[model samples]
Target: MSVPSQVDLASCADEPIHIPGSIQPHGFLLFLDAAGRIEGWSANAPEILAGQLQLGLAYTTLPLPPACTDLIAECIDLLAEGEYAPAVAAVSIAGHDYDAIVHGSHGRVIAEFESRDVPADTVAMFAVKAHSSIERVRRQRSIEGLLETAVRQVREFTGFDRVMAYVFREDDSGDVVAEARRDDLAPYLGQRYPAGDIPAQARRLYVLNTLRMIADIGYTPVPLLGAPGAAPLDMSFGVLRSVSPIHVEYLQNMGVHASMSVSIVINGRLWGLIACHHMAPKRVPHAIRMAADVLAQVMASTVQSIEARSDAELVEQSAKVRTALVESLLIDEEPLDALARHADDLLAATRSQALVSVHNGKIISHGPIERETAEAIVRAMPADASDILVRDKLGEWPQDVHASVGKWVGLLGLPFDPPGGGWCLLLRTEQIEHVSWGGRPEKLAQVGPLGERLTPRGSFDAWHETVRGHAHPWEATVLANARLTQSELLRASNARRAQLDSTRAQLLAMLGHDLRDPLHSINMAGTLLERGAVQPTLGRRIQSSSNRMQRLIGQVLDMSRIDGGMGLGMVFEPLDLAALVEDVIDESRMAYPSIDYSFANPGPTCVRADGGRLGQVLSNLLSNARHHGEVGRPIVATLAREPGWAVLEVANGGAPIAQDVAASLFNPFKRSSLHNPRNRTGMGLGLYIVAQIVREHQGEIAYRHEHGQVVFTVRLPLAEMERAGPT
Candidate 1:
């Protein structure tokens, strides 16, 4: 005989098995229409019947006696009620006995007959075995446990040498998660089979036909010959249907003489299969196959129940993580800082190796990564990307990202342009998997006349491949949980901003009241002075009120300028600090002659500063001392020059600053910082303005308690002062 064409065998996967027109000759098949007429019959149909089964003839006219007809009619009625109609009826036709099976679907009926006395109690016996197996399957607490028990029970029930729980992964590739086999036979447990092993059409058939059995791999095919004008039969539900030639070759390559598989349907989808294989030719009876189908049904429900519980736990954990991140943000003033606080925790939660967070052009990372890699990732990402970009295999990604990610196998990107720029990317490293395929993966594709062809490998030996740049796939729940985190953080950021806005509004209202009180004092003093009824006290009060108004206006303008990011336009010059202090004190003496002032400077300390701003700082400090100083005690001002620094000290004998109040003493809009009741009415902006000026001049200011007195000191670099020389 000529050699079979390798090309034809390679392309056999695309074969239309549904209309293959032939079936295994183990049983005879008859097709009936909606009216119960014999519309078609297999080539072997005449073997079991008393005579030829005439096409277009009513099935009732057949010589299948009353009891067999009634059993078939009852099965048909049950099928109409959406229940699986039981077959296995006894028929006595023309002095010959036959075991018949009936199935009704889609307004068509198919009945098959075998020349055997199928045990009269086979259905009852199978039911008892099925119930026992289902009870065992139900007792399993996890999907793995359920699959393990299912394979064991199927192996025992079918008497196959090996039975495996073939589960499909997210990529549609399958793996033997659990298995049961004879000790002598080598195990196929945990071996991954490529997705091409089972074609898409075959998966569809598994959904329609839950039970499939092959008595022997080499059985002759029985063809179904339709009459003229008849459509080819749809054998999707055929039990003894002829197997796909490619699949047959595949089994033969694996040293299997017979095989059977039952579909595990979960949530109306084909989840996996309970595959049974025998090394020697074996014939599994219909009764055993029926028992296996029931076991699969129970297994499907058990798997779904276990998954539901696992999903519930995952959701609970995700909620807890989100709550913690939100609570962290609630107390934090900066949104980015809050997100950074949970960076490590969030990275661990996603089960990734690393995470990167970008906020307003600043980047924070939780794992070991190079700056170039981070910039590469940011470059590849879309600016307005709102959806999570998840990749399972980094090697499969576009070259731009693939090269950048390096050994990282997976990534979950949450990119968003928040004003300027903000995004987050989580990464996972490759898990080098040494997968064991059933056959030599290299031989599966051979160099034929054409470049490459899909061919069954000759050796069913263990094959190894070092899978690189690919991680275990991310679950849907993981992506969803991360998405939820991004959304929660965004909401938290908005809430924090709103809180700040409310605080600003309250500050504005307070400023309105504070400004009005000072304005009213000036207005009353000016009116009294205009009427020539102003005493010395009234005249001094008017001057003090006017000075207070000018100070408040300057504080507001300085705040606006600082917020606008405008640096102080300093006219730096050599200034005599001792002389400046004397002038400020003389002015203060005129304003508050009741309070004594003393001044001292070791030398003429000349320094560089914005003279106007520096003088404003000194004036504010002296004013504060005057208001909060001990009554009848002299306020002392001293300037001293030290190595590379100029020090200014203003000390007053009064209550020291409270620790809590001192902490925010220079923060804008902080509450009153004075000990006197009258001084508490001023806007809390003078110290803030002074602090800003000091920072702009690159100087340091601090408060200290010395000998029951509150001492404020200023320290500025004296490098330039030394260059200018002592005055």
Candidate 2:
């Protein structure tokens, strides 16, 4: 990620705020000595601080009114550890209520007391309303509907004129996807805002505060005072903490007179914001903000689930298409011809408009492509272009190629020829977009009384900008497809090359290593179960991983049977690939939570194959993704179906697989590290087992490297086995 510009970055972090010598007028502050005597107090301390007496008086003797003394004393139990938490309690004295914040700093106990006249009946009312709202939000099945309900519930609870669900993008910029507003207000839905609008320091504050409010944008900030040479106080935990000036200006420019915000945080990061705006100055009760916090928890969990789901879908789609392409290549003796036969499916699987296969200095074009353009693409290809090369914009092409700007704006290059001579290029045409921003994105310089200074935009009118010279950047689904196809074609080429100089002793050398890891685990689990020390999750892992191992062994044995001129021991039955995909993702959640997954199931993709063998294929593919893919980013899996075939793909982002390794990807003993990266187990028969299974099933499996990810795919034919079909 690149650093955002400092000009637009607004943070008042360095100002001496602890000794600001003032406090928000709505609150009274007191500093206590070691013996609990009042040392210093805010100027208005006399009016609401219990009409207490002068200096050196014990603060404990000032108020004993409604059992708040015990709560205050309990707060100080951990004061030695510097626990200065806010929002301790709501204590009522003489028919009025005040919120208390008692904290310890520098061996001195400081107390802040504020009153919004917090109604006595508000808690009971809010509890009932929150319970019903939570039940309704929990009923939503899709993430879109869930978060939409969250913002609506908050809007109703807070009585704000407008409320928007603002979710952050990959670049930290935000978009308003859901909104609730009065009819008189203009809608801010679907508008994009720049990153620095809330700055870095403010983002940190949000995580700490969880919820913040500005009663009136036009009100002056009340400064907290300290001694002349004292350090500033950290008000990060203060409920009435003032906001940054730039943010206030930003709100004013948007025609908002008052605002309140709830931090929708997920796993320690600020995922998004629930922003509430009022056209008039309005103070939201503190009790309502606390209720909003409850909804934030629901939104955070839902968002995490949605992100994981999207990743799983992408993985499913990539697996489907790449697997299909690889399977097609295995059937045809001439790969170029196979490419032509599967042209339509390949294009459909990837986010591309065309495919161009260049071999022996000759170009075979498909789907609205030209020979000259294909030749130029080959010349511009990278040196080691065996891995997939993706370019979203066609910059500085030759005059002839450049002439077709909108027609061919994006390109994906997959080299098939030994070095850089042959290539398969996927193309994407330009897509024009109209963008709306909350304000003009550019900064302005004004010659004010002070020297030339950069100022925030004065107006936040809807700014429209027409964007061009771009195409839909190849998504992980298509990139994974490309990588898987590249793998298969390269493996096939290597097998053909080996035919000229192959030998026998080294043929099955890799199988010399035993598949003992799963067997060992199964043995241990069985022993423990016999001894009555049963662990369900452990037993399940042993069962699942061992079953996959058995399928792999069966696939190999079946291949050996064919090689030895013996009959096969295999069963065929129709099964839904989508169901298998869901099972794999759910298992991965428990086993490999570090890797985010996207499983895309276009529909009910079914194939006639051995269910156990296919599960092995999926298990191995996901295992490979977890070990080989990038951390933090989603590993995409895809399942696609055609007239007679089902394709499954697994794609992950990381360093591109090198040409030498990709060439031997399907051969035994060519193992990559697992998730831990330190433990190197197994005979490396995973892909070899997968390839044999695909071949026996009369389908195909392939590999490729695209968009910095290694993608593997398995393809199988769908059979018309009836309900009574035997295996």
Candidate 3:
């Protein structure tokens, strides 16, 4: 046959140019001019020209019959106009029909040919067949629908007992989604077959061969070539003949005696299969099989279209759901409730049963399921886990109430930690039908707990039979894409955490280094002054500086500890509250002699507390009052014992903290205002430390503005102190 220009004939010029073997046995070539007139013919042209023309006649120059002549002319015109590529068609020569092809190159028809010696009826039939195929393709609603139709048509036309469009599952399993069968045959429309049934080696062969047939499972194989240097003989059933006998046996076990499969390739990979099976041994002519193969090609395109559309829809839906969830989390403040309300809809959209769990390492709040049951699930999952579809059964749940519940068939966990110290668990349950493998017959008889009466054999008998014809349901590409998205989100979250940690470390280092230098200088000056080693005025100034430095250093350390998540140890004791307040007052007066201080203590008051930390709390409050309040105003220090705790109040006539500032006052390094730049000397950790210390003592600390005065109070639990007895 004459090759198309696009076929790169030059590449094969040096080699013996033999025709590519095809199921269609007859081959012919005809050369045509740009104007559609035949120019020349190959030496084999007579095979096609025999019955239609006389010997030595120039068929190329002769006017063709109207039936095929117009069709050829139209093809030539389209090719010259660059509308058609090298394409196949059918034409009439004399009273006979011949399948023909025209090859175009350099804006001209280079070659054309038609089969010879065909009957007139076959020629007319061929033309009608070619037109029908083209029309069917052009009228398809969608690629998937088109492919489905194509497979059905092939099965009907080829008289295959059972034909199916089998697609690969994400886990490599195969499923039959579309099927056509004889009236007496049962359908396998949705049936799923295990990956092992196909085997890696078998799958590779299917993809490589593109089309294969086991004409007769019991047929004695005919070996095309013998072993190297071996004598030629009837080598049927030899290992080298064709398909392995082992595979044939496997097919027979599945009740299929004869089978033909064509690989559906998408994006250069084996996407699935178009499979035809027969229960009885059958023989199909080569031409008929070639026609079926062409139909399969059309089906492949349809499959691609369907897959693309489905993917687009999935992506759009996922985007919407993910956006809603994330927005509610960052913007709504109450994300948990929002998620709970929308949980059902979200689960349905994803075709999953979702569970959300909130955990703080020790405490957990499970969604939907019982807390104990949820906790058990969490414990079963590993931290360095990946998403999976669990098919094996989980025998029993940890909680007794759920003892009779069927084992968990499938689970997917996605962990997320919110802004605070809690984790959000996104879990999905696998569909029962999928997990049970549609209830295979061989494994159904196995007994388990909940009594033998409830064995899989009995429980799933109806379901097993019902789902036998159902295809496996899974979209591997979709899940893979989702996993990639989740991984990216996790990576970003980890990166942000690392950045925050680095910033915190740098800030702590800066604070410690900056504060230590001043503290050392002040301490040295204080020692000299206390020893009378400086002038009286200098000594007084040195003492004040030393006290200020000590306060700064304490604030730095306290802030550091809190930020570092260090827990506090409380040495609780029943102490005389009155005496403690009096001592705090005496110390404050001694340090700020110019500042007036008043102490009011309920007589013989007693409570429990860590004395040193409490003293530090009192000192920080008093110092704050002296530094920020009216400098010379009297600072009131009051102590009293209520039913369950001791209360200490430190008040001064200072500018009251703003509402916003008061809310965050206990936060480290959070100051009231930046109005007084000169007084910004403190690191803003005093009150924060005070709150920490009081909390360690099992106390509460708070501040409120009252009558132009700011009052800070510390209330400690009395029973805690009493239990400790002494520090």
Alpha-carbon RMSD to native, per candidate: 10.4, 22.6, 14.0
In candidate 1, what are the lDDT values of residues 1-727, reduced to their tens digit?
Answer: 1211111123333566765667787767777776677777777756545364776777788767677677657656666665345467667655655667777766677777655444647656756766788799989998888988888877765678999999987667788899999999888897888777777898888887888877777777777765654666667777767887667777877888888899998876778998999988786666667778878888888888888888777778778878987876665433444566677777767778887777555565767887777777767666666667888887657785777767766888865335435677888878888888877554356664334666666666667777878877888788889888778766766675565566567666766776787689888887887898847787667676776667667776776665444545678777877788888889889878898898865767777777788889999899888887888888999888777788999989988788767766665555554223857555666776787788667688889997999999999876564856659
| Candidate lDDT (C-alpha), each | 0.74, 0.68, 0.55
lDDT order, best first, reads 1, 2, 3
Q: Point out the worst 10-residue segment of candidate 1 by lDDT.
A: 1-10
Q: Please give the lDDT score at residue 3 for candidate 3.
A: 29
Candidate numbers sorted by TM-score from highest down: 1, 2, 3
Model 3 quality (TM-score)? 0.45
**TM-score per candidate, in order?**
0.68, 0.58, 0.45
- The stretch of ten residues in a row with the least summed lDDT in candidate 2 is 1-10
Q: List the candidate 1 regions with Cα displacement exceeding 4 Å.
A: 1-14, 46-52, 65-67, 74-99, 114-130, 343-349, 367-380, 396-404, 415-417, 440-455, 498-727
Model 3 error, position 419 (Å): 13
Candidate 2 lDDT, 531-554, residue by residue in tens: 988676876878776775675476
Segments in model 2 whose C-alpha atoms lie over 4 Å from true places: 1-24, 28-87, 93-95, 101-114, 267-269, 327-332, 335-353, 357-375, 386-388, 394-407, 411-426, 447-453, 474-496, 499-727
Output the worst ten-in-a-row residue range by lDDT, candidate 3.
15-24
